[model samples]
Target: METGIRSLRRRWAAPLAALAAWTAAALPVAAIAAQNTITIVVASSPGTGPDILARTVSQQWAAKSGTAAVVDNRPGASGNIGADHVARSRPDGSTLLMAATTFATNAAVNRTLPYDPVKDFAPIALLGTGTLALAVPPSFPAETLKQFVARAKAAPGTINYGSPGNGTPQHLAMELFKQEAHIDLFHVPFKSAGGAVNDLAGGHVSAMIVPLHTIQPLVQGGKLRVLAVMSAERAPSMPQVPTFREEGYDQVQVDVWYGLLAPAGTPDAVVRKLNAEANEALKNKDVVASLAKVGIEPAGGTPARMADTLALELKRWPPVVRAANITAD
Candidate 1:
């Protein structure tokens, strides 16, 4: 009887010990995931579209997951400073980076970036997408895209067009338009899009390729006239404005995008977790309403899709930068 009892105990003990080990390992992982405070670093200034989106999403992300999420702005070197900080952070999902089209643009223009654009970060999700508008001052004679092109062809590099600044997405989009249309309109780089809009309203500049959100009010108020939009399709906010494709400018598509990323070594589970949270926030009624007010269309998708966007843009913009010789500094 004693020998039989010992044999049964030894047989059961191994399985019990295995279960115990698993529990011990899993409990700490659960605790760490729950305890870590997520810091979402926005590589842009306060009140910008990306900053606003980060705050809005984090508000709900924290509420849903019971995890603390915060936004920190580190705006400089055209957002490279903040992004680099996150790149070098531990890949524990506690540190994240929110960036816009400038992220890829900076990568395309600068070869000496501190972080590898592809290898140093893992994409979480694509936050949103927006477009730039081709607007002329109210008094400018060109009322349509056709007329605008005609005027440009008549005098290459004679008319001055404005953008937020050299090497900005707006500038690059216009450069792409110029290349596609075979027109050489002179560039008038402004310190800010608002300044360019002001000059356009005042008839100081002939035309501008500005963001629809920023210039929408002026277009509605009759301060500026939008001849066309540089999007794949007509923007919902400005359906009245035809797309460049409608006028046979196929290569003029320039859609500005925003995305989230974590350090390269961040676990795949964490990336999926963040992506799921972002997609959920995008579907929330409140999030949709707020983003609409900013004239931004929410875009949430797989990390792979976001990665593909970055890869495509990196391929698309380098040639344009070289051709335009654009330098922000």
Candidate 2:
């Protein structure tokens, strides 16, 4: 009887120890789930594109996952402030960055960054892409992209364009357009988009390449005219507008994409959870509508896709920045 009891105890001992180990390993995960409150950091001011996207997605994500979520705007240094905050945050998936096109553009234009765009973050999901349109004051001579190009070529350096600031996507888009069209247009950098658009609508600035929705009000108010959209296809919001490609400037396509990212070393499981939530949020009808209002179309995809997008942006912008001599300051 004693021999049989000893054998049974040995057999049960290993299984009991295994169960205990599994339980110990799972407790932290369970606690994390219970206390999960995601904070999405937007490297821009409130109501900006990135901030809007973050709030729209996070609301749906929180509702779906039963987790609390918030947006923390840290607008400064061309979005590096908020980006650096996320880069240094704990890799527990509780903090994320609502990265915009500047995420890549800043890296390309700036000589040094606080964190490595490629090495410091794990991409979660690509939220959406915003279409860009070339706008001119209603009284400008050019009514079409071809006409605009001809006018610029006829009097190079005479036509001026405005952008929100140096190294912004709008500024870079026009620079790339100038390179492709072989025309020179003076760049008038503004302190903010509001100021730039105000100037553009008031005819103080000749032209600007900004998001379609941004200039929609002015276009509707007859304060500005959209010469051509810089997207590959016509924007759905303004289907009547022609694309640059259609207007014979096939190389002038530029779109601003927004996405989510977490600090490097975040667990695969946590990343997957966040990615799934974000993708789902993109599919929500309300989310789609809200983004569409801002000229953004949903572009939900895998983390790998986001990584590829960032890699491509990083590669694509350096040449343009170099050619344009764009600097963050």
Candidate 3:
């Protein structure tokens, strides 16, 4: 009986020890995966351009990486709130910012930001760029870019242009247009893009410079007309609409770009991994199609390219903001 019991104990001991070893090995991996779960923070409301772009890419990235990811919209202070949040988060590569052109523009216009736009975040990938279009109500007399410019020149301050608000890209773009065209137009600021678009469609406003996709429905429905796109070249989504350069306003180019960024001090390996995943996501056919629907052209590239873009925007907008006397209010 003693010999039988000893044999049974020996037999059980090896299997039990193996099971314990396996469980111990698996625990750290589970913990690492939990730590790797990413949170993409967008500094805008849920349906905005950055939010959509973040969701689209993150969905593909998570599927490819087999990791969980989510977008957290912390909209306020013209994107500063969400940006600052990511800046303050742990530099563990788990929290990222889905930054837009406003990231630089905010720094250009505001003197007291909570985080340094250049130093607080590290550029990861430039996801894409969306074109801005100059749209007018159907009743506006301008039929072509030349005609629009001529009318604005003739009327000067009598013609008004609406924007999402003061210090916005729309406001600055129109101000740049005014400078390039040598025309003066009254500036009408709205609390929101929807408000400005609704006013433009209702003919309460004379014209507006907004994302092409945002006003496409109204343009298709004959409520608004696009005179020119504010891109270096005509947008593929609306090739019929000429570019500002085509209209002979070569200096009036403003393409809104979006990128991904991580907190400063995040490991270089983590940033490289995120960039590669983002570039792969951008190459996905479904992702490309989805972005195209909203006038965003895929612009995947190395982190250096994103850094160059941010640097250029930072240099470009400060003078414009100062000249136009733009304010965040």
Candidate 4:
């Protein structure tokens, strides 16, 4: 009996030893997870606003955390594809989504999505929010919101405006303008905001409501005219331009935002670490200056605040879309 017991113990010893060693190795790796790679996926093409913000902020995160960070661009389907991808990713801090205002707006309108914007994603922080500038070519007849409204009202369907895509912030912005000012105009869609702004500068489109940073140079170069801004207050970069609210069109107020999010079920420790890194990134002076150059202001806040903001926007866009009869292609 003693010989048999010794044989059995010898057979089990190797397997048990291997299991112990594996667990020991994994514990250190898991404990040091704060230094792991954090991947941020943006739902737009490179050089776009979100893409720029993600890359810029990621550099700061990497510097602060002493780890490499990646920014992936997955542009298409009005941000649904990328958003869905992040939502379905492992609930690890390694996979994150750099969500913009579209997350809430999409949720407001779309009845079918692969994942729940609110439930399937954990909000990390609100990075920044800024307004879109409504610009027309220098050759166009309007230079102010009232003038533009007058032109559209006088010409009706003859007036044409361009947007990044249907149901986008730019699209809804102009739609809100139409509804508030009670004017009829034709809609022109482009693949991207830069494209629309380019066409607007070239006089292919009558007007465009694009991110302020994109057309700031053109506006200064006498190639484009900024009729009005869509923020509640004037953009600091262009304080001379009046806001829609100041122009007596408070209903025309619309602003875009960028935020950070991880897949749902991410460990609280990982989420807190990421949130700390992100907040530090936002506070970096270089990041602040870069954001300001693009008319973006850093807005670092708790996950709960971002979630609240998303919920508010989710509640806001449906009625607007229904009223404007906006549809996705």
Root-mean-square deviation per candidate? 6.6, 5.7, 8.6, 4.5
Global Cα lDDT for candidate 2: 0.89
RMSD of 1: 6.6
TM-score of each candidate? 0.89, 0.90, 0.89, 0.87
Predicted model with the maximum lDDT: 3
| Candidate 4 structure quality by residue, lDDT tens digits, 1-329 | 99999999999999999999887555533643745577789988888778889999888877877777788899888899899899888776777898998887777567787788878988888899988878889889876888888888888899899987888878877887888888898999998777888889999999888888878788789899887888888777778899888888878878899999888877666667777778888989999999888778899878888888888788778888999888776
Better of 1 and 2 by TM-score: 2
Model 2: per-residue Cα lDDT over 125-189, one tens digit each: 99899989899998899878888999999998999999999999899988988998899999999
Please identify model 3 stretches exceeding 4 Å from their true place: 1-34
lDDT of each: 0.86, 0.89, 0.89, 0.83
Candidate 2: where is the Cα deviation over 4 Å? 1-32
CA lDDT for candidate 4: 0.83
Candidate structures ordered by TM-score, highest first: 2, 1, 3, 4
Clashing pairs in 4: none
What tens-digit string does per-residue lDDT give for candidate 1 at 1-329? 99999999999999999999887655533643676578999988899888988898888887787777889999888789999999999777788899798898888778789999899999999999887789888888888999998999998889899877777888888899998989999898888767888998899999888878988788889999999888898998878889999999988888878889999977777788889989998999998899888877899999999999999998999999998887656
